[model samples]
Target: MTPPNTGRRSEASRRAVLTAALDLLQEVEYAKISIEGLASRAGVGKQTIYRWWPSKGAVIFDAFLMLSEGAEGGPVQLPDTGDLAADLTEVLRATVTELNEPRYEQPMRALATEIAHDPELAAIYAERLDGPLREAKRQRLRRAQRAGQLAEDLDLDVAVDLIWGPLFQRWLHRSGPLTTEYADRLVATALDGLRPRR
Candidate 1:
């Protein structure tokens, strides 16, 4: 029923739409962005965008995902040097740098703002972005726990929340500079309680 060229055109249009959506997000806050603008910037008909995504929020999320490569640009696996403090400190420091990068900041903020007002977008984002990141962190923490580097009684998920929550709060709220020093402090405070002690 569909021509072979149809699939190629659809893919091309989708990419253009996503690229335009990301560009617009950088220039305008999420609340102010519109489908008409996205279509014009993308050079596609409004119908093309609506066919692929239900909302601008969905387009923005997909764009972020594509840019980050699904958050795989960072360390693929947690550093397990058998030293919990060092490993966590290194990871958090890298995370701070990643969050502070201008390329990631605006779009991330846009997505966060969109999620707050839209439950459906929040659910999709959780499944695509949040869930993967949480799972990776949990797996890393579990490794530390099994190595006796972390306390046997420590809850990995809660521990991850404790360590990462402050960083997220700072980035999302613009509360403070997300520096290596700040990340180190977070890791230190969280590890002080988590690390196995004599």
Candidate 2:
């Protein structure tokens, strides 16, 4: 059986460890990070970090997850202006800006690289981070459906992917510029395909 948790102090240590992981990731390549480094930077014992996280990849993934959830330190929620296209565009444009920001971009790239190589870490990321974010996207899409902006028959999962996939791909591959104009076009194109037919 697992031991009982240490409540607030443990939570504080976890936050410190995560913050240290992000700071180290930004300063050095992912491959260079180690448990010793993280523990030292966080001012926690190596055992403490190991007790909570299984590996350096998990630590880095969690750090990225926290920042992605909210760069300004608040919960991230999609806007429900009752305008589906506009809402998506606004979110995507904000994503573009965040992706361009050095603080978010570098750590994100590290986490992405780690996820690609570590299947277990990837599964954790999908469950903890991607799942909630996708659900939120679906919720916004559902609102659009209710508002008569999207077709009732549309698959919310596929719709979420269809809308977010391009921006992600572009960012991952550096395929093209992620400008607001591009975001607008993506929303317009996706909405055109998703809207109810006459």
Candidate 3:
């Protein structure tokens, strides 16, 4: 399914559909959600949804993205108060909170599952969500490098993964708690290698 042309889309209807999707997701498991349910909840025709979104996963993903963007209306950004360790700690702690939030956990897991199996949807996820975020993380790392806080020759891409990969793995596998303390440890341990040599 082709991505919707924003030029022709109605903002009001789009918001309704996204809101309905989130509401419906809260009411039932992801596997149980249907386009019909979304249409009815949103008070729009099924064709309206089909016109804009390629699949159920796409709609749900957009809903989560919208929620993340928030009422302030901006792309989410990682904290960059010039303290690399503190900024990473703050971001990771928030990640733990979001991953553990009951409202978000199921829908996020559902999206993750869809991205894993559907190459097209996965591409969209990476393009719309993951890419910007990784860039922001790298931007922060670059700042640290320039300030002589981080290894000058460090690979930002791998550094981003080193900090985030474990937390995600733990959450995805249910291998351990995603507590603030765990987030702190992840940042500290990753920074041990990232910090500039003595």
Candidate 4:
């Protein structure tokens, strides 16, 4: 029960809608982004957006997902270099780049601001953003622990937070420059403290 071109059209529409939603997020605040605006800018009907996504937050979250997953590669994943420090550094370095991208900055800020004000919106963002990102990090850390790259007694949850918390603070707070060097230093410091002594 599908036309030959239906899938193509749907794919195109999804891209268009995501594009328009992000564009509008930059133009307006997160609270202002609406399905109606996305539909208009995407050149699709409101029903089209509704058919694909249950809510506007879901649509914007999808856009964020697309950006994080990236276009060149299928999706971003934690690195595995057998050196846990190196892997974490590379992943964090890439995250710094993603955070600094001009296209992502405005929209992410809008989302953060919106989430700060709306608990429901915050839940949606948590599910869409943290759900994937945190879980991936947790898995990687567990693997590193099993490989003897980390302390056997270390709490994985605490380890994940220790790795991500500072960078996220710097990002959300605009504390200072987010550079590869900074990420590397963080990884080194954490590794020195976390890796079990021989």
Best prediction by TM-score: 1
Sorted on lDDT, best first, the list reads: 3, 2, 1, 4
- Tell me the deviation in Å of residue 53 in model 1: 1.0
12-105 in candidate 1: lDDT tens per residue? Answer: 8888888887788778867778999999999998998888888877888888888888658764577777777888899899888888887888
Give each model's whole-structure lDDT. Answer: 0.84, 0.85, 0.86, 0.82
Q: Write the per-residue lDDT of candidate 4 for residues 95-173, one digit (tens) a residue.
A: 8998898898976776666677768878877776676778788888989889887789999889888888999889989
Clashes in each model (backbone N, CA, C under 3 Å)?
0, 0, 0, 0
Give lDDT tens digits, candidate 3, residues 20-124: 988887888788889999999999999999999989989989888888776335655678888888999998998899899988887788788888888999999
Model 2, range 1-198, lDDT digits (tens) per residue?
A: 334566767888999999998888789877888999999999999999989988888888888767765554444479988777778999999888988888888788888888889998888888877776788888888888888778889999988888889998999899999898998999888888656759
TM-score of 3: 0.84
Give the range of the ten consecutive residues with the poorest summed lDDT in model 4. Answer: 68-77
Best by lDDT: 3
Give the residue spans of candidate 4 off by over 4 A.
5-7, 69-77, 110-129, 194-198
> After aligning candidate 3 to the native by TM-score, how far in Å is the CA of 160 from where it should be?
0.2
Better of 3 and 4 by TM-score: 3
Model 3: CA > 4 A from native: 1-9, 71-77, 193-198
| Clash total of candidate 2 | 0
Clashing pairs in 1: none
> Candidate 1: which stretches are off by over 4 Å?
70-76, 194-198
Candidate 3 global lDDT: 0.86
Candidate 2 matches the true fold with a TM-score of: 0.81
